[model samples]
Target chain A: MDKIKCECGHVNPEGTVLCEACGKPIEGNQHIDGNDKKTLLNMRYEGSARRSKTYTNSIVDKIWSFFSSVKVGVWLIVIALIASALGTIYPQAEYIPPEAVSRDPAVFYEATYGITGKIYYQLGLHELYGSWWYMILLALIGVSLVICSLDRYIPLRRALKIQKPKRHETFIKRQRFFSETEHVTTDEIHSVKEKLQQQRYKITEENGHILAEKGRFSRWGPYVNHIGLIIILIAALLRQTPLLFLDEYVWVREGEQTVIPGTDGEYYIENKKFIFETYSEEDGEIYKEALEKQEAMVPKNYQTNAVIYKKKGETVAGADPELEVVKEAEIRMNEPAKIGNGFTLYQAGYQLNEFHTMSFKVHRTDDQNEKALGTFTVDMNNPKHEYELDNGLTVKIDQYYPEYELDDGEPRSISKFPRNPAFVFLIYPPNETKPEVSFVGIGKNIDPTNENEYKLGIVDFDMRHVSGLTVRKDYTLPIFILGALIFMIGVIQGMYWQHRRIWIHPKGNGVLLAAHTNKNWHALKQNIEKAIANTSIKIVEDQQELDKDVSKRGGES
Target chain B: MSLEQRKANKAHKMKKRFIFRSIILILMLAAIVYALVANFNKDKSIYRAGDQAPDFKLEQINANNELESIQLSELKGKGVMLNFWATYCKPCEAEMPFMEKLYPEYKEKGIEIVAVNLDVNTLVVDRFIDKYDLTFPILPDHKEQVMDLYKVGKLPSTFFIDENGVIVDKVDGALTLENLEKQFQKILPKK
Candidate 1:
């Protein structure tokens, strides 16, 4: 191949339209035909590193050009899809057996799932999505998209911006749709321009020539879609950061307060009440029988009346710390209650079991004589509060234990029911500054010392039902939503819009017209014929047939 | 240049572009296939040692031999030893006696030892409990809910939770008598 030397001392390959070193056209490059010149002008990076001799020969340049190719981009996408599919063959590590994660995955796989499991673990299919290779594949695709779009965008923009109405006779003659007519006056040109304008074409008029183009932005559709996709990928990677997303399950039994996890215990959600309802047969005959039997009760809806509170001071266990209700709403499935910041409380599920309440009897023993102080009831759901008593004695119920048991000299609750309810109490006698601590079990005194002057004993209680809820806080949700919307728009533009252009110039007192479209040539042809109707313009032969004839004539010569 | 020469030049350029693109595509495909076969596998637990222990429910046979459901959330404000074990595991069996020995002392200080047996057979679990003479609650996790929640990977895994339901420490292997004592003390509620 011969190298064309430009005036700026740059040697470009034969058929090069633009100089590789300087942003100037190669002078007297006869190898580039009129059609090739048009295409070269439409390119974004006329003198990009991919085309420069010195740059393209380097190793980094080779790598850059490799990724800039659209074929490489498609290949990367295909690989990512296959890897994702393989990941589904075996359950991802998160969904696998809990034991499988800790031990040698190969051994666990062989012990549990047999030979296929061994192969899956051996190939890293267990955690394919999070693997370094899969991440690298995604990163490569991103690089390919960026380089591909940028390499073409600049020249394409310049070509579209600097389009002129007048072109070389051969350039106009070579278009797929061409026509001419005699006696084309200024009035005829104005009429043709008006006709093009009616079709929403952006017209640019020059002396004895006119250029009309439509859907110019359509050429940018692919780049737009690529940008949207890149944004989505970046957002997905950001979501992996711990601070950007949180998914936690919390169980706040009816009237019980629990700290929402992942919030640093700064907020608490209290379930005021849990409401569960089933579709009644009266509402629909299909559910009538099930509702009567109460056997196949299909749940209509379940909700939890929840209150979110902001912690005021340090949370002290077994004491009612000061808290202010920040937000109150009913949390239901699909209808989460937005709490402080981006935190949301969802009523995920509920449990039905026997609930329990604890009652205490206060007695003052003086000189072996026992006197009744007062009786107080402690609701297990809301027990961490002080209860004022008569006779100048104050009692604070610190904790309530259902099914209380003693293990190795320690007092604890073994079950959630009222089988053996126990209450921890701090009693302040009338004249004593120090309060007496006591553990009162159902029907018995559990305190080993039995040294308190005032005795607190659990007198009575009952059992009732509870709900479960899930809390979530995701900061990347907005970014995901915006990216999806932009992607949808880009897809519509890239797939449905077509870029079309037409040129009209005077030739020997007649008008010569030519037209081209990036897609849908048949439609472009019909549009050209419609635009030039009611005029003296004559349709020429099809551009492809004309080219074939020209080639045959050249062969004969 | 003649038309034939121009056509020939165009064909040559097209062929060069196609070859360059094809080469890159082939290389990318080869690299992807190699990665699929040679990538290393590692799985980490979702819930760490210091993270708050997720709550779950299980059914256990009471003293009267009736099935009663227990929820871990109800044990909030109390130190809890959440142990996941199986009847057939020897290490689990070996640690049962030590747990039984420490159960009473910890229970007095408001610490409960909930030994969750990941056995579907209640008869086997009952017999195992009888053999060890264990007095603590032996919850039967027939569905393995607690096991999955805790991501209990070994034969005998234990999580020690403080009064605030925060997991103070997690043990993956069977705890010896001394280790049990140390963990139990750490999980005991502050007076």
Candidate 2:
């Protein structure tokens, strides 16, 4: 094989290790660890562990090194940064369709990163706070943080526990500050020690050599704080689970009791009052807009007949309402009545409702048809008695709308609580195929709307208010809270007081002092320099007079 | 070694540690920006409020008397009103006659109205159309592709496309002829 001259341009031989002419290393066989004759495509795969081969270190050892290595920590920080950037691409806790949530290859990339809005939807990227993936990422980060912290924690504890006074002479001499003096005795140093003690420094004297370690043991606090953060993150994630569901919305609606999807009892909320209290942001004004601005008073709570029924085994359907399970009672919105191990209700919101004049059919339109299509105004709160109707139709109030409005040609109500009452009727008979629904406005002409010859009119109208209540059952809250509290404590302890070590040695006539800290070294240095000002030393002088000196140096130029 | 010198050197190193903590805090804030929205791709679906619509053919309910199929491409010189409505939706009933007045006035400006009915029975639709005295295209969307393709979740939707079949704007609820004329002005070129 022919060999060309390399710049520093010196050539020796084909398999030469070094260039004999210029005494420079040859660019020949030494760097040719593999064949140069073979192309990259034809190169045989080593199939060896590349990381291990490159590192020549155990992965565990590497992980340990990485945990302590600022470089690896920086890389982890970079990963966190990149991950955060990815987070900005979409929100977390987005509306994820269940089918796309699985790790299907065709959808995984799209679902995970949300290339085609899937990232926005299925991945819950929009609602990042409560998303499964974000929580998982947080969990992974927490685990790594825990593992990394634990890995450093043990060694740091052990290392910080004991002090080796026998440091290298060169290291002690190489310290940034030192002083040379002869006449001072060890007795004169007692005053300095007293002063340091006054500053709340912990002084530990080991062997004949005096080793005073202050703020020494506190260095391990940051590690403890890390463990706390992991716990806190876990607690945060736990709070978002289905077991700890937090459904926050205004009122569910009055008289229309929901079964409390995640809880035990079916809370029957009654809208007793929907009072909107407002205050003025500007100088105590008493206007409606000002009041709304000052205090965003929403429907506070639900006051209703809360009947708790046992899990089916306790009573028959026909059994008396008194025999039903009396688990607990609650008014909702901060007024909870506890009866057993199970519930708690909070008033998240209320529906602003009004009374309605129901129009239901009392009699059948046809004699053959058994259907009694009628317009009756029966109170929604009490459907049992006191029915009223305008004409032949016996009306029963079914659903009431308070704040009613008309959209398109149909009547629609904004408020379900009957703030402005309207009736939805079941008209039976003569025209049973399609029941007539006419919104007879309060005191409006209904004669024109009775186009159907078999007129069904409102007989009775009752307006009773109702409220919607929310009930909750979450057993894991206390545990999750406990985790958070513990985490906070750990974090405070670990993050504040860092472990700082200083080595002091007598070098001939000069004393050599070298220091190292687990965290906040710059502050530690500044503090050391400040403390050094008290001591009569030139080399270890404080930073107080440097600004003037720098000004002087600049002024000369 | 001098007794005074050893104490002073240890003090200086402690000051440097505090500076390291501040840098870490700044990076933490910068990393947090990734969780917010950053992408800026404009949505250009023809069903959306602002996009060029494609030509389509639909049967016109010329009045209660006759039915004639109208192609949007054939009426390329004039603006087109595409209304997606259903019989069950009450809002569609209120919007019908207003469109009739609009068809005659704007038909001179090359404006044509195509009402896509999402219903089953022709007799029911025909009766409603006859009752309302509407003079516009009343085509059936029985195949359901247009509704599915347009992703119309709500009924009584209307899309105003230009003479070139480019969709200029759309509305979810019912519209009166006066408001529709204003919408036409927004999409149409100024003379």
Candidate 3:
């Protein structure tokens, strides 16, 4: 490749389509055919040579060109959007039942939704957003955006920066809007310059030639938006890194603390109390109609008084970790408590009146009135093997069932929740030879042997509320917000402004006038016509309009 | 400037840009590949079949009926049956008898059954073990740490690990005696 030197004595880089200083079309360039004056100058990138257009041999050049193509970029965006839409056709695997997802998601989809769901599962559409192929699509789009902007932005910047006030007559004539005058006075040129200055155009003059440019910053709008889009895509990909994104749920009983999941055991949250209120007739007249429509009581508010704690230091396994209080706040629906390290806890749900403790009394079976001997309270969650009553009788637990149920002829529990608690008590009386065995529940009392000297009777029970908190950790939130703001700025800059340039030069005893704009050509032409008013210079005509009329007549014929 | 010299300089700049862009593209591709590979690998927090059973230490009632801490990593060379259960779970109780019956026979064949109880009260677990006469190691997860470690959503969930400590099979619900024996055979030592 040989460097081309324009007749004006300006040296240009290899593959230069037009001289950087003088704007003269370089001979032997592929973009220029023999005698280029007949066609409009391809002013995209200001006729500057771009890497993607110049190179085609090497593999790197091929890859660059592939990503630089606006066509390819548009196609990638369309395909990605379609793929994302397909993901929403059904519930994602994460939203499905936990048991189904944990055991076999394929079976669940097939069993629930039949053939389409099976196909969806088989194609891995249930987790479409997380699929490797979908991520690759997004990565390809990001790469395309970066390359497309780089392919043109560098050359455009260089062309704008290296531009001169003087340009060749042929280049000016080939512009979409062009005109000429046989005689132009220096005073008329000065008047035109003054009018352009009034219009906020930046004017540059060299040897009586004038170039006026306005809104040049708007030309960088597309590239700036592309950069913002690339940042957004990168932030989306960053979520794959561990701890950058977290969504988990934890249930903490009133007065009990629970370790927040995804915090690496570094944080814990305690619920002091769970408050639940419902709208009633006594609430207000405004909610009367809405409340009356609901068959069941409508909830008005639910909040959890939460206290966050951070682990102090390393602790041995199976031992309690020492915790230091971090903060305390009330968490309600849509109002989350912000803990440090990008974590927030929201009150998601509440279970009211869960069995917490149960009390029992030892009763003598021989007494007519079933006189109570001694009373003992049992913590349903952490029960003791034996309980000593102040009245001198002792009762020992032989068996316990938190959620008791009868299966066939055997007594067992269906679950570990203290919903329907039952217990087998061994009542030991003072100075007695043997202990009496009794089966006791909330409303049932039976002696298995049917000949016990003592029995266990239910006394009182206590219930507490459990609050469910959803913990969310998103460190990429600030980056996403920044990207969105930059994108909005780019869009506003591009849409609300236009880059306009006017070139005026003396050529062969006549003055040539040409105008160009990135968009809103009508506005630019009107501005030019008004600026060159009351001057000897002729108003510029839109050559594109004349060409379109000629083409239309040719079509009609 | 000489035309030849200017051409050479232009070529050098192009090559430099190409190298710089190539490195960036390669690095981006590498990051994407790393993310995909990390996703393909099972998260250690979640346990499933074919995953390396996460090592944990828990307290169990031994032959002396006393609380003794045992580690899963300590039984690496033995085929282990790790069962997450609670004394209140009926399905877990239904499978206990089969586990107890197979415990003696399998213990002689380099197999060990370890039950992790997700009960808040150790008394219930002890009473259940006594009533069932279960001889296998019964660990009490009083704080439910081991339960959370395995992410057990339901009771009677069992992980069958081979001698190499890799989980060979996992059942989320109750298994019959025959099914339990079959699963045990899968993790039994070859010899």
* lDDT by candidate, in order shown: 0.67, 0.47, 0.80
Best model per DockQ: 3
Error of 2 at A252 (Å): 6.0
Report the C-alpha lDDT of model 1 over A1-557, residue by residue, as the tens digit: 45566565654555455555433555554234233434223223332233322235445557756776777889999999988898887677556443332333545566578898889898888878878878788878877877677556644565456456665555566556777677776776777788889988888876767788898777787777777876776676656554566677776666667666656556777778888887875687876766777767778888888888887986332233478999889887899888876788877878665445666778864534445678777665345457878778888655555557776775555443444556677888877678888877756665546687778665565654466777788887888888788888877786677788888878889887887666777877777777777777775445665453344221000
lDDT of 3 by residue, B90-151 (tens): 66777789888888899899998888887766777778777888778888765565666677
TM-score of candidate 3 to 2 decimals? 0.72
- What is the per-residue lDDT of model 2 for residues A388-490, given as tens digits with 9 covering 90 to 100? 4454433333333344567676555432234554444434333245544444445542434555444344455644444444555565567666766766666
Cand. 3 Cα-lDDT: 0.80
lDDT of 3 by residue, A1-557 (tens): 55577888887766777778878888877343222434666666777776676677678778988998878999999999999999998888767643342334656678778999899999999989878899789888878878888878887899889989898777888788899899988888888999999999999998878899999988888877877787787677667666688787898888887778777677888889999988899888988998778899898889999899998988533446799999999999999999999898988988888789997777778888877787889998889988988777788888888888887978877666777888888887886648888888868898889998877777788998989989888888888988888888888888788889999988766689999888888999888887989998998988876443334221000
The clash count for each model shown is 19, 97, 0
The whole-model C-alpha lDDT of candidate 1 against the native structure comes to 0.67
True contacts kept of 2: 0.00
Worst 10 residues of 2 chain A by lDDT: A40-49
Report how far residue A453 has shifted in candidate 2, in Å. Answer: 15
